[model samples]
Target: MTTVGNRSITLEDFYQILFKDNAIEISPAAQKRVSDCFAFLLDFAKEKLIYGINTGFGPMAQYRIDEHEQAQLQYNLIRSHCAGQGKPIDTVYVKALMVARLNTFLRGKSGVHPDVVALLTAFINRDIFPVIFEHGSVGASGDLVQLAHLALGLIGEGKMWHEGRQVPASEVLAAHNLTPLSVHLREGLALMNGTSVMTGIGVVNLIHSRNLLNWSLVSSSLLSEIVESYDDHYSAELNEAKHHPGQQQVAAQMRAILQDSDLVRKRHEHLYDKKVTADVLEDKVQEFYSIRCVPQILGPVYDTIASATTVVMHEINSVSDNPIIDKDKGSVYHGGNFHGDYVSLEMDKLKIAITKLSMLAERQLNFLLNNKLNNKLPPFVNLGRLGFNLGMQGAQFVATSTVAENQTFSFPMYVHSIPNNNDNQDIVSMGTNSAQITSKVIENTYQVLAVQLLTTIQAVDYLGFEDRLSSVSREVYQQLRALVPVFTEDGIMTEKILKIKEFIQAEHVQLPASVVGQPAAVAATELVAS
Candidate 1:
C-alpha cells in the first residue's frame, strides 16, 4: 500500500496506484490537520462572511446567503455546475484527478471535512471513478464544471464507473458500505475550486509522451541500422561540441543502442582509410536529415518533456485551492491559485513537440518506402511482384493524414481565452482543453509510429538484416514481427496496424538508464519487471 499525505506524491507513486493497483491510506497527521482546519472554518464562518460560504460565487458574489440556507448553497453549487458535456474522460484519468484532488485536500489548506479525503481514498483504491467530461472547464476558476461532476459523485448524486460499467454513485457507495460526503463549512467549494482536474490530465499526458519518445528513439536507432548509415551522426565527438545537454544525451543513447551493431558504418574506416577512384561515389556521403539529425531534432523534445515534468510535478504537490485556510495562523487568505496558466502553456508546448516527433517518423517512413531516396529496396518495401503487391502503400495514407490532423490540433490553448460568466471571468486559462488535446496528439503520434515500425520491419525482412542488428534492435524486431507477419501481397492492414499501436503503447520500451532514468537493457523486458 502507498501512504498518501505523509509526504509529497511522486510520479512513481502515481504509476504504482494507477497502473499497478496499489491501495492508498491517508496518514494520521494529514487527517488531524484536515479536521482541525474544518473546525476552524466552522467557527470562523459562524459570524463572518466568507466567499463561497456565506456569499454567492463568481459574478454573483455580491449576493449573500441566509444562515438557514448555507448548507443548501454548497449543494446547489455542486449540482448546478455538474452540467459538463461531451464524452466522459477515461476511468484511468479520472482516478488521477481524484488522487490529485485528495492530495490537495490533504494539505489541510482547503478547510475540507476529513470525510472528503476518506471518500476520495476509498474511490481511488476501490476503482470507483466518477464520470468526468472532456468538454467543460475553461481551466480558470479551477476546472469548475469537470470538478463539479467529481463533487457530485462524492455527494452520491451522479454517475460513476465501477467494474467496467456506468452505475449510480449512490448504489456503488451503498454496496461498498461507504458514506457520502456531507458538506461542512466549505467542502463543496474546496472540492470544486482547484487546478487538480487539468493537472491530473497533464500528468497522464506526461507519462505517455515520455513513453512515446522512448519508442521513437528505438525506431530511429533501428532505422539507422537498416540503411547501414554512418555512426558519426550520433557520435559523442560530434554531439559534444554542441552545448545542449539534450542533444548530447540523445547522441549518447544512440551510441549505446548501436554500439554492437554490424550494420552501421564507421566514417573514418569507410571513406578516410581508402582512396576513391570514381568521381561520384556509389555510397552517398551522408543520410537524409531525418536519418542523420535525430539528435538535433529530438533533443528539443527531450528538453520539453523534462521542463513539463518539473512544472507538473510541482503542480501536483501544490495546494491549488482558492481561499487557503490556515488553522495555524488563525486566518483565511483568498487568491487565484486555481488559475491554470502553468499547466496550459506546458500542455500546448508538449503537443507541439510530439507533433514534430510524429512528422519525423513519417519522413523516415517515406525514405524507406521510396526506392529512389534509398536506392536499396523495392518501392514501398514490397516483397512480392512489385506492381501486384502494392505493399505498405495503402498504410502510408493513414500516417500522413494523422500527422496532418495533429498539426492542426497543435494550436496553443493558453492564449485562446474568451470571457464568460458575464465577463466575471474576463481572462481564463483553458488548461483542461489543452491537456485533452495534448492527449489526442500523443495518441495520434503512437499510430504514426505504429505504421513506421511496421514498414521498418518489412524493409528489415527484405534485406534479411535481423541477424546483423544490435541486440536491442534485434529484440524489438522479433517482438514486432511476431505481432504482424511480413506481407508479400496487398491486404487489409487496419487490424495489424492497430495491433502494433497497442503493443507500442502497452509495453514500455526499456531505454538506457541514462535515457529514461531506468536501468539499461541488453534484452527485451517490461519496464515494471525491470
Candidate 2:
C-alpha cells in the first residue's frame, strides 16, 4: 500500500497508486498532525473571528455568522457550489482528484477534521470515486465548483462511482462499512477551496503525454529504418553539434532503437567510399524532413513535458488552500495560495508541445501513404490492385482529422479566463479547463499514432524486411502484425485502429537509461488500463 500524508507524493508514488492499484494508508504521524491542527483551530476560533468559521466567503466575507450557525455555513458553502454543469469527469481523473485532495489535508494545514482525510483515504482505497463534472471551475479561488462536488460526496449527499457503476454516495459508503465525513472546524471550506481538481487532472495528463512522446520516438525510429534512411541524422556527432539536451537525448534514443538494424545505411559507405557512375542517382541523397529531422522536431516536446512534470509535481505537494492553519506557529494565515495559474500555464504549454508531436506523426504517416513521396511503397501502402483496393487510405483521414482537432484544441486556455464571482476573481486561471483540453489532445494524438503504426506495419510487410529490422522494431512489428495481419484488399480498419491505440498505450517501451538520459520510469511508462 502507498502511504499518504507522512511525506510528499512523488510522480512515481502516484503511478503506483493509480496504475498499480496500490491501496493507501494514512501515516500515524500524519493522523496526529491532522488532530493537532484541528485542536488548535478549535481553541483559536473560540474568542476570535476566522474567515470561514465566523464570517462569510468571497465578497460576502463582510457578513458575520452567528455562533450557532457556523457549522451550517460550511455545509452551505459545499452544497451551494455543487453547481457544476457538464458530463461527469472520468473515474481515473476523479481518483487522482481524491489523492490530490487527501494529500493537502495530510499536510496538517487545512485545519480540517481528521475524519476528512480518513474518509478520503477509504474512498480512494475502495475505488469509490465522487461524480465530479468536466466544467465549473475558473481555478482562481480554487476548483470551487468541481471540488464542491467532491465535498458533496464526502458529506454523503451526491452520486459516486463504484464497481463500474454510478451509485448514491450514501449507499457506497454504507456498503463498505465506511461513514461519510462529518464537518468539524472548517472541513467543508477546506475541501471545497483548493486546486486539487486541476492538479489531479494535470498529473494524469503529464503521465500520458510522456507516454505519447516515447511512442512517437519509437514510431519515428521505425519509419527511418523502413526507408533505409542514413543513420547520421540520429548520430551523436550530428545531434551533439546542436547542444540541446533534449535533442541529444532523442538522438541517443533513436540510435538505441535502431541498433543492429540492417536497413539503415551508413552515410560514408553510400557516398564517400563509392565512385559516382550514373549522372542521376536513383536513390535520393537525403530523406524528407519528417524522417531526417526527428530529433530537432521532437526535442522541444521532450523539454516541455519534462518542465511540466516538475511544475505539476510541485503543485501536488503544495497546500493550495485558503487560511492555512499553522499549529506550530499557532496562527491561521489567509491568502490566495489556491490560485492555479502555475498548473494552468504548464497544461497549456504541454498541449502545444503535444500538438506539434501529432503534426510530426501526421507528416510521417503521409510520407508512408503517398508512394510518390516515399518512392518505396505502393499508393496508400496497398499491396492489392492499386486503384481497386484501399489499404490505409481511409485510416489516413482519421489521422489527419484527429491532428486537425488537436491543432484547434491547442489554443491556450490559460489566457481565456473570464471574470466571475462578483469580480473578486477578475483574473482567473481556467486551470481545470486547460488540463481537460490537454487530455483530449493527448488522446487524439494516440489515435493518430495508432493509424501511423498500422500504416507502418503494412509498409514493412510490403518491403518483406521484417527480419532485417532492429530488435525493438522487429518486436513491435511482429506484435502489430499479430493484431491485424497485412490486409491486401479493402477492409474495415476502425476496430484495428482502436486495438492498436489501446495496445500501444498499455504497452511500456523502456529505452536504455544511458540513452534516454533519465531513469527508465521517467523516460517511459505504461498507460494504466482505462
Backbone N/Cα/C clashes per model: 0, 0
Off by over 4 Å in 1: 507-530
In candidate 2, which residue pairs clash? none
Give the Cα-based TM-score of candidate 2 against the true structure.
0.96
lDDT of each: 0.87, 0.87
Number of colliding residue pairs in model 2: 0
lDDT of 1 by residue, 6-73 (tens): 89887767777776789999999999989999999888877888899999999898999998888899
- Per-residue lDDT tens digits for candidate 2, residues 65-125, read 9998888999999999999888999987999989999999888898888888888888888
What is the lDDT, from 0 to 100, of the residue 180 in candidate 1?
92
